[model samples]
Target: MSNIVIYHNPKCGTSRNTLALIRHAGLEPTVVEYLKTPLGKEELRALVAATGEPVRALLRAKESQATELGLNDPTVSDEALLDAMAAHPILMNRPVVVTPLGTALCRPSERVLELLPVGPLPPFTKEDGEVVNDSGARRA
Candidate 1:
């Protein structure tokens, strides 16, 4: 077992499920409530790099502020997006789990399982399950 850090938002169902999966996998993860303690610019940038995605990919596009601030506009620069995410934690995507081996975006609760060491997680049933798609819907 290695250091597993989860950037979580308890309010989000997917985030909650991801945490549950982590615990079920038998690996203790350091949960960072990103909304309470927002990530700095450097950390945010590093996370994006770790995920191998553009800065915009880490943003919560549904956030009202994202639209209010015109973040969706292609004209926005990467620095501006990073600043926005750093300033508004809600704009940062939820449940990003990082391990020494690699990092993953736990959008769908199942994705978090990939980061865990080989083990059987608690059975995922219909009741406590949600699937995240590219569109970001929590299909229960």
Candidate 2:
């Protein structure tokens, strides 16, 4: 099994579903409630690098602080955004799952499956004899 860590926000449905999927897949991941125990600046930067996404993409744009801080404006610098996220973890995005090999942003929740260790998940049929769809709901 892959060594996994999940930065989770319990209040978010996406985060809850991601945890459920991980458990259903038979992989136990270390859960980090990021809102309660936030990531440091260095860790946040590293996660951005690991995911190969821009700093803004990692932020929770819907957060009121983002608007209050004028983070939605294109003029906002990466440093400024990072500082905001560090200061207000509520502005950080939902579950960010990391594996021994790589990390993924579990946005829709299903994305975490890509970080799973190679091999099919254990088989379990639904009541209708169809495989369970662990893939999460699509976001707008």
Question: Which candidate ranks first by lDDT, i.e. highest?
Answer: 1
Candidate 1, residues 1-140: lDDT per residue as tens digits? 44999999988988888887777667789989998899999999999999987888889999899999999998899999999999989999888998765787878777876666644444654225443222222212
Per-model TM against the reference: 0.85, 0.83
TM-score, candidate number 1: 0.85
Worst 10 residues of 1 by lDDT: 131-140
lDDT of 1: 0.80
lDDT of 2 by residue, 1-140 (tens): 43888999888877887787777777888989988898888889999889888998888998888999999998899899888899899988888988865777878776766776643455434333444443432222
For each candidate, the alpha-carbon lDDT, in order, equals 0.80, 0.79
Candidate 2 residue 13 C-alpha distance from true site, Å: 0.3
Error of 2 at 92 (Å): 0.4
RMSD values for the candidates in order, in angstroms, are 5.7, 5.5
After TM-score superposition, the amount by which residue 103's alpha carbon in candidate 2 deviates from its true location, in angstroms, is 0.9
